[model samples]
Target: MANTTSAKKATRKIARRTEVNKSRRSRVRGFIRKVEEAIASGDQALAQAALKAAQPELMRAATKGVLHANTASRKVSRLASRVKSLSA
Candidate 1:
């Protein structure tokens, strides 16, 4: 129940921002999933490529406030390690 005009506008803004953030989060997850799938398939080359592509996307999400800096870094590190292990 937004009574004031500003409140109504704010509510709308929040709705729009929520949609954008949701999309960004989903996109980041999709990228991560690609890397994981590649790794699981035991294709080291594909996994490495996917990780290369996902790294920037993950950082972008963090920069846009969709994820925390440390969270994104941790994810990148874990994924990278997994990709590395795939080669061994």
Candidate 2:
């Protein structure tokens, strides 16, 4: 129960932010899934392309505070490595 006017306003703001964050998180996940699917399909070219596309999205999520910077970097690194291995 938000008794004060300010508290009520903050609650509304939080709800709005939560929705936005959820969308961003989902989008990031979708990008990662695309890369993984490409990798799983054993298409090096598609996996490379997917990883290329996902890198920016992951970084954007990190910059926007949806994910930690290192976390995003780690994901990109791991995915890139896996994609690269498909070349060998």
Candidate 3:
């Protein structure tokens, strides 16, 4: 469907970028899941550690445009609160 050579190249680039973004999204989800699992298992220490590890990954995903800034912030906030409650 691309009429120009440049357009074809752009399409290719988009496809590659989509794959990369998909991977990043999946990775972020995996990190979040680990935190959730730890929390559900009632291991406050493991949950806190998982949250610590996931915070930067979530922020990085937002910075890279895989997630919105507010969305990432809200997730981090909620997770942090839950972790705090577990310890307290």
Under the 3 Å rule for N, CA and C atoms, how many clashes does model 3 have?
0
Evaluate all candidate structures by whole-model CA lDDT and list the values in order. Answer: 0.97, 0.97, 0.96
Model 2 agreement with the true structure over 1-88: per-residue lDDT tens digits: 9999999999999999999999999999999999999999999999999999999999999999999999999999999999999989
**Where is model 3 poorest over a 10-residue stretch in terms of lDDT?**
79-88
Instruction: Quote model 1's TM-score.
Output: 0.98
The list of candidate 1 runs beyond 4 A from truth reads none
| TM-score for predicted model 3 compared with the true structure | 0.96
- lDDT per residue for candidate 1 within 1-88, as digits (tens), equals 9999999999999999999999999999999999999998999999999999999999999999999999999999999999999867
**After best superposition, candidate 3 residue 78: deviation in angstroms?**
0.6
TM-score of every model versus the real structure: 0.98, 0.98, 0.96
| Candidate 3 wrongly placed segments (more than 4 Å) | none
Candidate 2: count of backbone clashes, pairs at least 3 residues apart or interchain: 0
What is the RMSD of candidate 2?
0.5
Q: Deviation in angstroms for 82 in model 2?
A: 0.2
